[model samples]
Target: MVVDEQFRLHPESTAYLDAVRGMGRSVNTERNYAYGLALYLTWCDERAFSWSDPGFENLLRLRNWLVSTPLPVRGRRVQPVIRYRKDG
Candidate 1:
């Protein structure tokens, strides 16, 4: 498991990732999940929300934030910024 100094994942989150790896998940998939969960944790921390116990209303707020916020795309070339859009 890679240790990131900037963001420390909760023990349960680490164990979950390890389990996913033990299940033969691809490295790309594991990495993607780790990155995504890390981002969510960071967001929760910033908003003083408990990651393990964010209430339904808090989850809705998170959804709203995610939908409105622009996310950066990573690549070798110029990365585009995108936001999550909810489809009705």
Candidate 2:
């Protein structure tokens, strides 16, 4: 389920995930969707847009930001994943 930094369950996200799960999606699918929702909500929060109803322009901006920005480097203790990004 999606959660904030404080570790509380996100109500809307949890409900959505539950619905998807009830439809027979796998736990892996739930995890992936949860991650994506967290990213979208966090982006909306940073830009002071209402997460549920960000406007079309705001959504376009989010799309642009996602393509332009590099993904974060994630690592395990034994190995790290390296991603290369191209700049416009």
Q: Number of the top candidate by TM-score?
A: 1
Clashing pairs in 2: none
For each candidate in the order shown, give its overall lDDT on alpha carbons: 0.79, 0.82
The CA-based lDDT of model 1 is what?
Answer: 0.79
Query: Cα lDDT for residue 87, model 1?
Result: 29
Among the numbered candidates, top lDDT falls to 2
Q: Give one digit per residue, the lDDT tens place, for model 1 in 13-65.
A: 89989999999999999998998788788788888878899999998888888
TM-score of 2: 0.76
What's model 2's lDDT at 42?
Answer: 88
**Model 2 per-residue lDDT tens digits across residues 1-88:** 5456778887988899989999999989989898889889889989888988999999889888887777777766465565644543
| Model 2 C-alpha lDDT versus the unseen true structure | 0.82
Task: Report the poorest 10 consecutive residues by lDDT, candidate 1.
Answer: 79-88
